[model samples]
Target: MTYKSDSHIRNPEDFGKVVVIYGGNSNEREISLESGQSVLSSLKKSGIDAFGWDPNQESIKYILNQDIDRAFIALHGANGEDGRIQGLLDFLNIPFTGSGMFSSAIAMSKVLSKKIFLEHNLPTPKFKVIRTLKDLKKATDIFGFPIVLKPNSEGSSLGMSKISKLNELEDAYKAATEFDDVLLAEEFIQGKEITVTILKNKTLPTIRVKTNRTFYDYFAKYKSNKTEYICPGTSDISEEKIYADIALEAFEALHCRGWGRVDFMCEKNSIPKILEINTVPGMTKKSLVPMSAQCKGINFETLCWTILETSF
Candidate 1:
């Protein structure tokens, strides 16, 4: 394919042909903005017409009026990654990066994702969805103590808590309820924290995340350097292959495409259990997905460009 220079261009896109959707009504707005900026910068550096569009009043109106060819999603949590924006882009007939509506919806909801994983016979921590406080005990009975209590439909670990003792369950339950009506009392698998980043329906590289803290909580994940990550996960080639295989299967199982990340808990028993899938993985300098992608000779700029080019 021959490329044209600016002088030879008939009509160049000044405002950019690629619109980046970011910073919506999500708790992760700050990180989303960071991701948007980074992606925009990389796209611009790579000679692609790209610009950031926060999902605010003005941004929404402008995009609806504009003629961008495709969109790059940088938003996370809530209306951003919960299939709402994907549905909107679909309505506009604009091809955007990342999974589609059904896949985004399923991956965003903890309850729905766990169900799919369970149905696929994938190793995921067993859990019970608590419809009411009265059902907490039934959940604990099924999952046992040291369980992770999380809202069924939230992301970025917001309103998620790990209850090790019986006395901690109530408070954790109350906290998690602030985010959603339904909650999952997942059986906490005491082991290593790991993640898999996928792009274009392929697994990038497995990362074994080790934190100085007990687990990779919200604080440790985004705030503190309490975490240590091992690309390909300290596993031998064969073991890493196993993880990559499972990760790919889970990604396909969730119907994820374009790009996404799946998290897992690696137990000492050598069984890696599914945690959940992040349709919109963070793109900050410290994000894990980029780390995995970098392991395969794909820099952040190149990675962003590849995803954008695919949108065409």
Candidate 2:
């Protein structure tokens, strides 16, 4: 169902006690804290009896032991997004925002998700798995120079690098492996970067990301002010529809539900290549999902309310 502001529950009391999950023991803990606070504030402002829950401080058993009727997962990376917490919630029989355990695990792994993308005939960057120097050598030989190296399971552009030469491979691989055991060396698609946010099985406006950095790294995504975002990605209505359609298809391909974001790299006249899917995307002020929602006339409170409704 397409989620509009007016279609959501008007009374926040109906939501019961909600938990905004975030701040786990991950590389993205800081960001998760920010996202969780942002979501908690929005939910509270909307009158939804919501509070922040950091898994690092309190265990999942503690949370399940609470009176939480549903959860709004704002956590990113590692144990938080890797289906561990989702499984706990599933066992507790507590509804939560975003995809379930299976989909969460698949979406968190870059290697597995890319395989699904290819199997489903979805356009994604050509990629090769990297676990050793020998694998890196083979990837360099096949993909040539200017390949993107990133952890198999990471977010917020953490441990991602654009290797322009063979000498940089080892360093890039080392950085990525610090975050995940498996690394992915993908063909760098030189084009405009765009992201599409999906809510309630419907696509929101697309945002074209422009960064002065070599690529949209962790700094460019959250720290850099040089980044620019252009909404309604294309001037042509047909092109916009194409982007939205592809985004919706990609989101569904992974069985991603509730709400999520699909990132793409597109060149003129070429099909947009799916980069990855974010099941529990950020809710910070600089986040793409909230930015896209505002473009569609959905305020932060309404967006949070609509997302919480998905837990039902």
Report residue 90 deviation for candidate 2 (angstroms). 0.7
The local distance difference test score of each candidate is 0.80, 0.87
* Per-residue lDDT of candidate 2, residues 1-312 (tens digit): 223322467688978889999999899999999999989999999888988889899866777668978888988998778898889888877788888899999999999999999998999999999989789879989999888888889998888999998888888888888888889989989899989899998999999999999998889889989999998777778888888898888788888888999999987789989999999998999999999999999999899889888873
Q: For candidate 1, what is the lDDT?
A: 0.80
> Residue 275 of candidate 1: its Cα lDDT?
90
TM-score of each: 0.92, 0.96
Error of 2 at 102 (Å): 0.2
Cα-based lDDT at residue 205, candidate 1:
76
**Which lDDT tens digits does candidate 1 get at residues 1-312?**
212111122222522488988888778888898888888888888777877788764556788788777788998888887899989888888878888888999898888888888888898887888878778877777777877888888877888887878888778888988988998888888888878887766677789888786567778888996677788774578777677788888888988777788888877867788899898899988898889889988999888876664452
Q: Report the Cα RMSD per candidate.
A: 4.4, 2.4
Stretches > 4 Å off in candidate 2:
1-7
Question: What are the runs in model 1 whose C-alpha is more than 4 Å off?
Answer: 1-16, 57-59
Candidate 2 residue 308 Cα shift, in angstroms, is 0.5
